[model samples]
Target: MPATPPDDPRPWSIFLIFLRLGLTSFGGPVAHLGYFRQEFVSRRRWLSEAAYAELIAIAQFMPGAASSKVGMAIGLSQAGYRGALAACLGFTLPSALLLMAFALGLAGQGDALASGALHGLKIVAAAIVAQAVWGMARSLCPDTPRRVLMLGAAAVALLVPGAVGQLAAILGAGLVGVVVLDTKAQTQAEALPVAISRRAGALWLVLFALLMVGLPLLAHVADSPLLSLFEVFYRTGALVFGGGHVMLPLLQAELVPDGWLSNDLFLAGYGATQAVPGPLFTFAAFLGTAIAGVLGGLLCLVAIFAPSFLLLVGVLPFWVRLRTRAHLQAALAGVNAGVVGLLLATLYQPVGTSAVGSLLDLVLVLLALVMLMAGKLPPWLVVVTGALIGWLVL
Candidate 1:
């Protein structure tokens, strides 16, 4: 049983606690989840284990930043709207401020060491992503057909290498699941209670869509197309389901074609993001910095993540009610499967193409995979090993 809600009239304490959490939690989403479980479930006894698990599922399924969404949900569970707001501010500010500071520093200097360090970081990124895919596949693709879908998606991504390819694979896999796969067991899966409200839901949906459509147009009108770049990324963060990897293509589509950043630069920054200890979404800081300057990085951070906060506040009141519906559960299962496929697809292109440049690179990736799958090393350690290998070999 969960503890009774604390009536601590001082919401400021909640803000400070999460603020400290945001600053100190250094691992990626998985690590952050562990931290939340410890703090909210074990320490405070604020929510039941089941409730915590349900929130994680919803956050993972909804997209944007998975850990951030989870943090927001935890906040809402404690002190309502004010609690959620405080938690978000606390969790996000630390990383955002740090990333902005880093961007500012990088903007002024063009060092050979930085370039070399980034090269190693790219290899680490590839290793970490590949590890994530393998781990997810073991859990999500237990059957032969699902494995086929995974391989098929990877092949399609390699062959087509674009947004269309990714979308087609996701849609195709979902259709197959809905039409052919046996969902009887899935149908019987327990549903989580919905806690968000209709008004909030409508507001979130509307704001998400408006930002998606309006930001680019506003950027065009303002004569600084880069603002459009920020807007597109912002919307992508808000609307994308699954997780950070799912947002990769959407981000690529927006930035690569528009000439905001070169492929090498974008890939390099992505690689570096893995090494940095925070939300993978903070990669937006790199993109923002590349586009305008420190301010651009800050704007991109706000634009990309603002919608996530809004959506959490808007939808959380009803999550408990909505999460339990059969159709919604089925849809989420399909979406989860699609997410696995998407990650598999991603591995071949930017992740595979950029990192695996030689036989040595292949060897390093294989070793990293083995460490991740068999040894069960934490991702950050794997990242460090990959970087060390790159530094020594590449």
Candidate 2:
């Protein structure tokens, strides 16, 4: 592993900072990036802006919760592996605990106010995703070729309509980029703070692969419900590309069919996830609690997040060295455009169709969009206001 950066802070301090973010950071992954930029880059000065943006790039290119992985990267750079752990725990636990408590309280209950709040939260998701789609499209799909790729990806995602479709869209876009995009331009780059040894990075990667392959086999051989649960969540965490919002369809496919949870509960938990302040993956905690209990919640939380931790540790050491490659850049460009498309498709389906049941809900979504885009309101406030409105009107 690499030596800790000279300016490394105490792991406890890192934990506290992330914990505060966990309590207050309310928007989805895209918004989390802004929160991170404000906290680490502008305020804390943990790393240079370029270094921070580099970390964001790594997180975006990877297959997990982008903001969570970026946080992990930041922590890892500051105080080595332990700092990474502290950061993740601090950022994830508050939301996980809140969602778990909500799950336990919500079980077997059918309160209208609660239902209305969830409905409003779902509407908030629609607005948040719409904002993300708009913002990312303006940036990532700026050119004609990229714009075409984005639209094609959206079409594929809508038609295929599942994990298979998503994967196909990403892969196809990447291939197209390899053939069409020119990515030879280079910029002055700063080194990432961490310098974990390639050997150690390899080990972390091997462990990730082992669990990825072995978990399902072990679950199959053991035929244990717990193992099955772990495998399902682990796989989901390992495959989702864009961020937390994009994980929705994959989670639905994995859990709903197995009778692990109902569609209503799933969407409700997702909506509740937005209400809480943290990575969207914390929805796993609610699902696990619904399935079993506190223990199950912990299990799912760890299982779902484990891959992100492993992947970041594995890739961080190599990122600075390999980031300048032309093919890699081209592929990442394609994947990013494809991700925008996936998010666009996602907005209309499970998020929009499920939440906007009437003209009023549609109006609510528009209002929420305006709140986020034009009003400059913090998402947490919007979420709270939405819940109240939903409680009264929905």
Candidate 3:
């Protein structure tokens, strides 16, 4: 059984917590998820392990930055709309501000980030994600069938390599669960305190559809640069199924050819975004600032992330209710297993492959993992120490 939440935390408290996470939660989206699981699930006990897995499953099915969406969902579940906004702003602002400043020539981190410290940060990402995989696999994929499903999902994701493959794996797992997994065998899942009604959810969905379709048409008709910019980012947010990394090619192709930003500038912002400690979607802030200014950066940042908020708010109410159904619970079990698999695949490709190049890097990762799992040290501490170690030794 999960620990009971003490009380309804105020939005301010949620903001402060998420703000700290935004500052320290390095290593991109997969690593962000790991950090979140540690903070909210393991340490804070705001949600049960099962509930957290369900949130990941839902976020993976959505079309935006999965970690950011998960954060929003956690906020919304705990403290309603205000909490959701608070979480989004708190988690996104640090990197968005940093990237926007970099875009505007107010700060320079490129040369420094190219050093060994960055490599250590990458290693930290690997260790954190490895810990997440280890914990989630034990809890979510306990049985042989679900474990098989987990491995199969990982194989498919590794083989296929993209948003399409990821979505297919989760969807296929859900279908398989509905067929083969026994609902009676599944454990009871705690209900999420998602605060929207079905009618409200439907309205939000309708609004999402309207904006998704209407924005493009409005941009075309008005022939305004700002509207066009908003439309492009909004559409990108609505359409991209994977995480922030997947948005790179789409944004590059759209903005570069359209003359909104030079490819060099776009790539530079991307590199800076990686060096920061929040969602890679904050790259929008960089592009917007380069094109306009601070206001433009804020505009583009909100525009890109707006759809994610809408989709999560719209979908989660019904998702909360549906997951409790016996049949859906079975399917969710399979989806949960698939979510673990997706994380496993991510830990390998980008996290492990990028970080673990040498024997020393591998040793660093193993040491960090031990600290997280056995020593029970906080992830942020490990991350900070890893960067220092890399700066000194690597």
Whole-model Cα lDDT of every candidate shown, in order: 0.69, 0.83, 0.78
Report the lDDT tens digits of candidate 1 across residue range 19-136.
8787778667888899889987788777788878877766865658888888777777666667777877777776666666655665565554354545566666677777777767
lDDT of 2 by residue, 99-180 (tens): 9998988875656545677777778878877887888889778899998899899899889866688789888988898878
Error of 1 at 53 (Å): 2.5
Instruction: Sort the predicted structures by lDDT, highest score first.
Output: 2, 3, 1
Q: List pairs with backbone clashes in candidate 3.
A: none
lDDT winner between candidates 2 and 3 = 2
Q: Which candidate number has the best lDDT? A: 2
Model 3 lDDT per residue over 43-68, tens place = 87888898888888778756787899
> What's the alpha carbon RMSD for model 3?
7.1
Better of 1 and 2 by TM-score: 2
lDDT of 1: 0.69
- How are the candidates ranked when ordered by TM-score, highest leading? 2, 1, 3
